[model samples]
Target: MGLRLLIIVALFLVVEIYAYQAVRTLFKPKWLLISYALISLFLLVYIVYSFMQFDRAVGQTQHTMFVMGLMLLVYLPKIVITVILLGEDVFRLGASLVNYLMYNLPKNELMPERRKFVSQLALGLAAVPFLSLLYGIFEGKYNFKVIKQTVFFPDLPDAFDGFKITQISDVHSGSFDNHEKINYAIDLINDQETDMILFTGDIVNTHATEMHPWLNTFNRIKKYKYGKFAVLGNHDYGEYVTWPSQKAKDDNFKGIKNLYGQIGFDLLLNEHRFIEKDGQKLALVGVENWGKNFKQAGDLNKAALGVNQNDFKILMSHDPSHWEYEIKEHPKNFHLTFSGHTHGMQFGIEIPGVFKWSVAEYIYKQWAGLYENKGRYVYVNRGFGYHAYPGRVGIMPEITVIELKKGSNVG
Candidate 1:
């Protein structure tokens, strides 16, 4: 592990060196250059020290989050500069090789001087992410976008033809620093006035106490006619931290489950509830966090015990990977599944309808938005809050409002 860490640090230093070449080419003042290097060195040392000080028992905290934000803000742009400058080096190497082979140039003078325009271009490109990350930390995390999606199900219960369900997932309440913004987001959800509200969870980072301050804030969410419901997320299980004992972990898990009820939500734990409208019943089945890479505590069969395969069902599971790996192919034939956990990797370019891309796409097939497989659909909410990085980039936080329609075609 020590060797691996050393290798990673070495690579990080190499990227910094390559990135600095861009700055050196563009600037000539020695004092200014020395100041930049000193600042970079200080940040690198502090970041490494902070990471080394991280306590697994304590898990994520404001201090750690700040360090993570700093690490990303410092390195991501540098990586961009590194890649660009490295490409220039490759080209320069080829030119030097040709000069040596064809013109018999001396080895000492074989390589040509680096182009100023190339450095300028690299720095210009690097500025994009640097500014974006800064904006993300200060504002984008709270940039809540209401995404309305109307899904058509041929077998949708007739009485619930135009049912509107608002979903907010991956709350990660522990990471919230602005109550005013959260209240505004809550108001936005209330303004929708959807028939039902579903939260596919991560109510806290690792400890239930992380959500205590936000209790009344979240409690402000008005009750929906059909009711508000939620299911446990992987984080709610407190799996990320090292517990003193299993009982302590169990106690925290119990507290996390109670947080939903405190917020006026009926916490569903491998259970199902039927919402009846005009003599027609639609099944709402919820399972505990069942992630392909995380936990497998959710029991789908147990949750859907009373509901038949033909029943119109909407399943709420925390991780989208659950739907992709197991539920999608399950015989239960859930009409729709709501999930969050990917958070669109909290970074990616998403141009609605025209183009969408995230690093998360490589991991989960249904990373964001609505995805369908043989009439069964899953809508993955980008997230309601930010986590590790403490901010969002291109993919803004989401409040997904889905309307259920009875038809073969989706609008």
Candidate 2:
């Protein structure tokens, strides 16, 4: 552990040195440089100290969230600077080596001076993320977007063809700091007037008590006509934090489950419910938190027990990996699945349909929006709240409204 920590610190210093070169070249005044170095050092010490003080039992308090946010805000832009400067150094080195071979240059002439223009360009480019991250911390986390998607399924029941469902996932109520913003988001959900609403997990960061203050706010979600339902996500299990006792952990788990009920949602735990419309019924199967890398508590087979193989089913599973690894290939065909765990990494570039990219794509194939596999579809919500990072970048908080269409999509 000590050696690993040393290596990490060493690498961090290397990045700082490269990043500093850009600042040093851009700003010539000694006092200004000294001030920049001192500020950077202070941030480094504070971040390291706060992380060392992390309490597993307490878990995800506001102080820790603030630290996490500060760390990202301070370093992500620096990383961009470091990368650009490092690449320039590599080019300079190659040019120097060639010059030395051709002209027999002195040792002092092995490398040329850093270009002011390059440094200026690096700083200018870095400003994009720096300012963007700052805005994310203050405003983007609550920048709710109502994304509407219409999916066509041949197997969809005629009566339910035009049914609309609103999905909001990964609430992470524990991290909410502004009631006004949350209230506005809730109102946005209610405004949609969808036939049904579904919440796909991570109701709290770890402790269920984190949601105590927002029970009433969530309960104001206004009941939907076909009913509101939800399923658990990985974080809802309270497994990330250490517990004082097994009973304590169990009690928190129970409280978390009850939170859904408090908000008037039928919390489905490896269960199935039928939503009927005009004599035709559609199965809504929900499973507990199931992830390819996290827990595997969701029992899809058991959840769909009574539902027929021919019945049109909509599944609610917290992690999209459940669909990727198992649900997509299951014998009991699920026409549609709802999931939200990646949160688009709370950072990325997204432009309606023209372009979309995120770090989350490397981890989750169905990270943000809708995906299809041989007619079966999965819509992964980009989360309705922020967690560890305490903010969101390009991927804003989402309120997904999905319309069910009976016929093939028109191209």
Question: Could you tell me every candidate's TM-score relative to the true structure?
Answer: 0.99, 0.98
Tens digits of lDDT, candidate 1, 269-357: 99999999999999999999998889999999999999987899999999999998889989989999999999999889989999999
What local lDDT score does residue 384 receive in model 1, on the 0 to 100 scale? 98
Instruction: Mark the regions of model 2 whose C-alpha exceeds 4 Å error after superposition.
Output: none
What are the per-residue Cα lDDT tens digits for candidate 2 across 23-83? 9998889999999999989988898889889999899999999999998888888888888
Error of 2 at 282 (Å): 0.5
lDDT of 1 at 240: 95
Candidate with the greatest lDDT versus the true structure: 1
Candidate 2 steric clashes:
0
- Largest TM-score belongs to which candidate? 1
